[model samples]
Target: MLPTKMTEALNNQFNNELQAAHAYKAMATYFSDKGYQGFANFYLVQSKEEDFHAMKFYHFLVTMGEKPVIQGLLEPKSVFENALDVVKQSLEQEKEVTRDIYSLVTLAEELKEHSTKAFLDWFIKEQIEEEDAFRTIIVKLSGIQEGGEYFLKMDEDFSQRTME
Candidate 1:
């Protein structure tokens, strides 16, 4: 059995994940418009990942006998000066997400909801990987001139991480 408060929080978190997916889709469009196809593909993949995360929460809520509510997502910015800026903003957004996840975990602990904590453990590890990956990319971007061969090569490398 799940606590009522925890269930409501999970629904909100699910919607937030969906909103993050929307934000990544907007960023992908911005990259594509700037001719960074590789980065655009990266964000497209990110959007998909976010969608999966939302679904994960939704499934969990269903398993807990809670109704998953859909909330309205706000529009995200579609313009950035360059790939670095886009990814930097993404890293910051991800950090914010990590904070939210941590808060949920803490709440679960306070409420003696061990199941919620166990599920959130996966997200805690995943966030660590996400933040480190972007931090490394941001550092690499620091050395490369924007729109140059280096940028193109980096984009290609990033694109290789995507499915198909």
Candidate 2:
């Protein structure tokens, strides 16, 4: 049986994932409004990926014999100084998630919940990938000249992004 503490933590992470999807959707709209259709497409795919992550947690909770609790979402940030600002904020958000996942791993280790640790192993690896992706985008955004040909080419490149 899952411990109450662990169950609650997992539920919170599940809700966080859903919240991320909402935020990504907002970012998608922000991009679309700015006429960056490729960036918008990227955010849309990211939103879908967040939804998939949430569902994975839900299913995992069920398999672990815990009833997952659903929660309402708050409004996502809709305004940004610029496209680069959006990616910078996203990197911070990803770092926050990485910290949370690491905390969960520490908790699982402390509890000696081997199964939970094993389950979270996947998330630990996934978090690394997530953070790397955001950081890479931040670097790209930082180095490129905005509103230039490079910007358009990068946007076009991003347009082909798909969910993994």
Worst 10 residues of 1 by lDDT: 155-164
lDDT of 2 by residue, 43-158 (tens): 99999998998998899899999999999999999999999998888878888888888888888888887888898888888888988998888888888887789899988988
Error of 1 at 79 (Å): 1.3
Clashing pairs in 2: none
Clashing pairs in 1: none
| Residue 51 lDDT (model 1) | 93
Q: What is candidate 1's lDDT per residue for 1-164, written digit by digit as tens?
A: 58888988888899999999999999999978888888888989999999999999999989878899999989899978877898899999999999989989988999999989999998999899889988998999989999889999988876776643
lDDT of each: 0.89, 0.89
lDDT of 2: 0.89
Model 2 Cα displacement at 27 (Å)? 0.8
- Model 2 has a clash total of 0
Show where candidate 2 strays beyond 4 Å: none
All candidates' TM-scores? 0.96, 0.96
